[model samples]
Target: MTIHLANRVETLTPSTTLAITAKAKELKAQGMDVIGLGAGEPDFNTPSNIIEAAYRSMNEGKTKYTPAGGLPELKQAIVTKLKNDQGLEYAPSEIIVGNGAKHILYTLFQVLLNPKDEVIIPTPYWVSYPEQVKLAEGVPVFVEGKEQQDFKITPEQLEKAITPNTKAFILNSPSNPTGMLYTKDELTALGEICLKHQVLIVSDEIYEKLIYGDNTHTTIAEISQELKEITILINGVSKSHSMTGWRIGYAAGDKKLIAAMTDLASHSTSNPTTTSQFGAIEAYNGPQTAVETMKTAFEERLNIIYPKLISIPGVKCKKPQGAFYLFPNVKEAATLTGYESVDQFVAGLLEEALVAVVPGSGFGSPDNIRLSYATSLENLEEAIKRIHTFVQNKTK
Candidate 1:
């Protein structure tokens, strides 16, 4: 029998980061020493306090369906977190918790978009953005952020991308592939354009707590009251507290939109995991020492490995201000190494050198590749050495 699938499902591309990581695992399973830098997850364990909270929740018989959106306690905690961290206040009614930040975003697109509505996504973007918009029957308009601009799109560029069909602009600061952040002034300028054009802003701040050096994370919604009304702030404990498995994330914005998302989630997922919600509550409300420790470790790793990466011939990288990924332009390296593209170079590194890095083609930067420093300094050093050797030998 010939089975047919929806066109949306047929057209979706598998996540490149996951694909590379899985390939690395397959090689490792065959006894090759694969050093994978493709995973975006932190190598750290969940903080003990959060774990204990989940245990307590399970022991106390809290492992059941929660409110379709989230528990009041969890929602209130999120409200407090937003106020304390970003100085943005929100009522509980305006928030809805989903399985993770990814889920929240997927649901948001479904609720906010109509068929043929357009979303402006700046590249290089998280791999899922364009796919998610397409799943909701929305068109993704890509605006390339030039490499020289630290991979951040300018306000003028944003203004030119807007069309009558444009519904929202997706902003991921301390962006996933590039790890670059937008300054307060930069965000304000962008927000002004969005306001003038009456486009909704979806600000994904999952990496807010992982910043380094003098750079800071700012929410575009915090720029002004008007912007806040049009902005949907998406965040989660996964990146900040190493609670990826906990599966809890929330969104805050217009109450009507929140209600729609909540309704959609009710039928699709019902609610986030009960115990995970409790864990996330503790993650937000408990001591944050572990989060800071993880951030410091990532920063130290970046300090040690970034220079080594750039020291290789035909490589150039902008020092990332936040997040744990290093996106380096390797077009010259690819050309020198006799490869036709960055993807070929990355595949050769994995197959021969036993190192895994994601090619930037999926992130909309075909000339670059993304390496994650979320692993230990020892593994990172070895991976860099392997990459350097591979590049040199290929060139020779």
Candidate 2:
């Protein structure tokens, strides 16, 4: 007899970007020239200084596990970075480092949410938020934001979605999938709503440093002193320092919650890699030049690509204030091409144009698609040309 998987397994959905990346790899193996916009990673290398620090840690033999919360020095560096960059103060005791920002978020859900507790997530969210809430036996309540409002949920929308069981709201600025960021006034409004409802805010600021033009990223914790105790500030070195493989991310929040998360980490993954922790120290303490340089490149690419994408008939995209993604409303493309959904549109684009773009349905929206401008300028130019070709022919 076959044994069934656990009930928790039933609640999980596979990562859509990973699935698309695998398909792209399969096509490449079959001799196709696949341009993948599906990857969520930067195309840049980790900074030399950070790498050197990691090497030094290895030579100095820092391979063993330390405190599960994180190395003290690493936490101190994070504290300094938070205070200097964001005007937020967090002590080492209130910080917990995990394998990645994703893991830190999952730990928060596990620690704070009980079965049937409700989480408010804005639509066009990062794909992982809903699934993680479900894994913790919590329910996800989605608030839909259309293309007209820059994909941002209003404070009124937040108030309407609240229920007796609502426990937290997932807030991501310069958001994944949509690349939509809430302005400072907008965030303050949201913070006020959450404060009134006594709902915790899980602020995912992973792409905090990758914004463009005049757009500034702000933290909910910085909005008010009272909200500081209620907000979980999640960030890491991966996106900004090109240190994704380093497996180091940390959260700053209420001391009790931080301690619980660290206890959970101790019994589970233990301390994040020791060498990586040292590397993360340098990432936070060293020169900020690498991050600025990467931001400059991203901004240049955004300026070059956003206008080009809007010029493609049937594709509608606003210039994202930040982040490397361009989420275009391709519903018209689907209607003209006879594809019933965004997934089908993406499949057709991949098969015909040899380009990979993510369908927005994965992020809780349909009839739209996400294009990541994280690759080189030459690649971006060619991919858009191919997309233009595909769209023109579909019209015919």
Model number with the top lDDT: 1
Question: Which digits, one per residue and each the tens of the lDDT, describe model 2 over residues 160-271?
Answer: 9999999999999978888888888998999999999999999999999998777788888998898887899999998888888888888999999999999999998988
RMSD to true structure for each model, in Å: 0.7, 0.9
Residue 176 shift from truth in candidate 1, angstroms: 0.4
Residues 91-110 of candidate 1: C-alpha lDDT, one tens digit per residue = 99999999999999999999
Off by over 4 Å in 1: none
Query: Candidate 1 clashing pairs?
Result: none
TM-score of each: 0.99, 0.98
